[model samples]
Target chain A: MARKAGSDGSKTAEAIRAAGLRLIFEHGYEGMSLRDLAQIVGIQPGSLYNHITTKQALLFDFLVEHMTRLTEALDAALAGIESPLARLDTFIEFHLRYHLTRRMEVFVNNSELRSLEPQNRAVVTGLRRDYERRLEQILAEGTRSGALNVPDVTIATFAIIAQLTGVVGWYDPKGRLGEDEIIAIHRQLVVGGLLPIP
Target chain B: MARKAGSDGSKTAEAIRAAGLRLIFEHGYEGMSLRDLAQIVGIQPGSLYNHITTKQALLFDFLVEHMTRLTEALDAALAGIESPLARLDTFIEFHLRYHLTRRMEVFVNNSELRSLEPQNRAVVTGLRRDYERRLEQILAEGTRSGALNVPDVTIATFAIIAQLTGVVGWYDPKGRLGEDEIIAIHRQLVVGGLLPIP
Candidate 1:
């Protein structure tokens, strides 16, 4: 249902989504309860329906929204980047910065895939495959132009994505390494991995 | 307490561990219950205490046991490997093969780390650090000897581990690629990433 303009419904809906993401990130989707979620959002249990109809819908929305934002952001980052190697560099930088700042989304997206029901799971998986395909196309382009020497484009795609996204698992903003330093390290690891060996 | 030799108690203990792993893998640590675990094992809830004292203890044991066994296995894998490059190759092969066959362990190890109690979490985290140090040392030695050229060994260590351990998330036993092919892909990505560029 659509919320009327100037109504509190839109704000409440956004609050519900933020609360749901935090709860699912801290506790798995299976472990979070509607009662706790409503409490966190400062609403009555029954009133939760005004924002989210069901817990399953909340989870599906969370995953779909995350994947949608990721793909759109990537497309924005890759815009006007013509060289395949340069496109790959943009991907590595974009993934690390995006994931590091959005740890909740990254954790929930990766860990809660199993909690999604089969139908919901299929949709989320399809979105993820589309994201992977973007990187695979870049790798294929690089291989064709002799700019990269990946033994297999598909494996390289998965490995590079994994390596880049891993920053979320251990990155600390106050830690020794600065953002640029971490990004540069991963850039070298990824770009160097794809370079033609002499 | 120790079970009597040759008694069903030993078998029951093994069964409890196996059942616990499955339940925790399907449901988060917080989402699983001793009552359900007992029901799955075909035993009374009270009898679960005979195998595991409490759920917290069970979670701790699960994580600690997983980390402990992983370190021991790594030690065995790297024994008597003298060359830094060869040792790095052994690390890649060992990590990929080990994680691929133990998808449940990898999932629980990565996902349920948040569920571990503070003291238990520290112990498990320390064990993991020790394991990472094995690779860090190998990388440092290679850099000192001018055989490897990692920009930052610490970041490289985390990135490489995450890249290698990620195989468990998507690998399929009946898929097009066999185990050897998967290993070669990762080995090339890692070793090629580290080799000095001429």
Candidate 2:
């Protein structure tokens, strides 16, 4: 269990989390040692428990917080959009922007899924399923409205999400394409894929 | 460097590679130890030298073999298809079918790239880039022939590949969707995504 970061411990807790994310990102969860984490956090090994209880707890905290924030932010983004098509468009844009700068988070989430304890894994998986279900709902609604040309809403939902999330793998802000251009390109691909065939 | 497996050593070498793959897939390349690998393969730790010199070499071999087979299989699959649209369809089917049953390969290839040594990483990345370029070539040719409406050939190629490769994450043989139906759903998504607006 994570001790809630109170006023004095908040900064230290945040710093610890950041370092944990970096270590786990570079080294697999099993490869990252608590001693290394404590050193990186500028804390004595024994004092590390002032924030996170165990390494597993730290990982669980990172994953749960990541998913929780992601889900909430997405909900907030889709709040006022009524039309399924509009929501779908918002989804593509929102998902891309959210993940564009969070490469470490994306890598850890995808790669270290095997490292999470079973109970923690279930919690994270549930949150992930919630996120997927959000997209599934949008696709289902879009299909119901005859505004989307999905042959199978579930498959399309997974395909589109996978396509969008993959941008984190190779996208570079310093490289050829700007964010808008990239987003526009994906918008066309995703929307075009979903639009009814003429 | 990996020794050329002679007739007597070939079986042991193959077994080592198999165990190496499983260890890296389960524990990550960084997390897996050569001692543990030897134990799993039922060989003395010193005997590992008969097959591979170092853990790095084993990882390099795994990645290189995976990408080499992928690229060659893709080339073979696309060899006779003259039409770009037909080729694109074949590429999607080939990639999906090749990866669908090889979930461990897909997971390790994507997750363990960071664990490869710098020069080795470059070699694997180069092979992967060659593969990506093949798709880029298909998209470029398709766009040039007016058979596709891809806004950006490079972006579409990545997007489609990502979309198709994502199937391995959730696809199960006993699942409701069969191969043909799953293939059709993806073909519609990838082909429709590339097709010009009506």
Candidate 3:
């Protein structure tokens, strides 16, 4: 919502971003418009423009924020866990949990990506590559340590991720199994593909 | 691209769908339009409307076409394959390969799905559910025979699929691996998770 300019501007901007994300994730990038965002946030149309540069900026932020936050958390979780296999486990579970809670965010990340301008698309894509690179490193470490056996760590990393990204399209929080059970099953699935023989 | 009635009229319809698919897959459901498809296919804009009732119908076909084909192929592939694990492997590899080779179709099946109207959406989704039901049956059969070890077959089906679907978003024909090799690796990855204790 629009608010007093000076110190309160940032709050308005944040609110607009959140409201826009909810709409875009539900209606898709095509269905949602700036006016819709403004109405949702209870702000004047002109005032909404002040908070964000353009609709693309709101979408770009919506798309990348989840990955940005998750990768940072993944970095922290992977920090001291020296076991490569364990590291992979942590990453998959973290990914499942992230997608489970912010499933809409995951949908936006997968679908609304191309709506971004060329430069913005590259930045968001760069973040994805960064995450893949980290996973590739962990996988390479696993191969070296005799904990995993797979061909081409980089390829495997991407393959594993594609498997996980589908969660957003289908995961139901109110389903028969709770989130932890889903995570546990995914861990086994991922590990089955990568883990090495004793 | 418009042609005579009867047989030629069907061909005209195919041309329109092909053009729509090319634009939509490259762009998105929102990115392409009837005029664009007509222009790309070298047809008059008015003539385009003759083949299809509306833009949304084309969008629905875009989502349904490949999936309908794949389901047929899957049934063929899985038929009479006694080993549950073997059937699962075939499903995984076939999915990865199909998406890799026919990327436009893949994009249509995977992401442009939301553009369908409610009944059309249900039809396509039901087709997808049918495919998954087969996989779950196989998984259940494997578990029943002590051929695969898993606490839950249903969730595992989704997990396996997520990994397979991710392949399309990243796979490049010119990249280090060919489709067959990628499928082999996918087999290794999938088998690791689904196979019973070795």
TM-score leader: 1
* Lowest lDDT block of 10, candidate 3 chain A: A1-10
Please tell me which predicted candidate would have the highest DockQ against the true structure.
2
DockQ preference between candidates 1 and 3, better one:
1
Q: Global lDDT for candidate 1?
A: 0.90
Kindly list the per-residue Cα lDDT of model 3 for residues B85-181, writing each as its tens digit: 7888888877777667776676667775667788998999998898888888988998998988876788778777777777777777788888888
lDDT of 1 by residue, A1-198 (tens): 896885798888999999999998888888899999999989999999978878999999999999999999999999999999899989988888898888888888988888899999999999999999999999999999999999889988888888888888899999999989998989888888788876
lDDT of 3 by residue, A85-165 (tens): 888888898777766777667777877776789999999999989888888998998888888897778778887887776
Q: After superposition on all CA atoms, how large is the RMSD of candidate 3?
A: 3.0
Clashes of 1: 0
Q: List the residue pairs that clash in candidate 3.
A: A147-A196, A148-A196, A162-B166, A163-B162, A163-B163
TM-score of model 2 vs. true structure: 0.96
Residue-wise lDDT of candidate 1 within B86-197, one digit each (tens)?
A: 9999999999988998999888898888988888888889989999999999999999999999999999999999999888878999998998999998888888888887
Question: Stretches of candidate 2 above 4 Å error?
Answer: A1-8, B1-8
When summed lDDT is taken over every stretch of 10 residues in candidate 1 chain B, the lowest stretch is B3-12
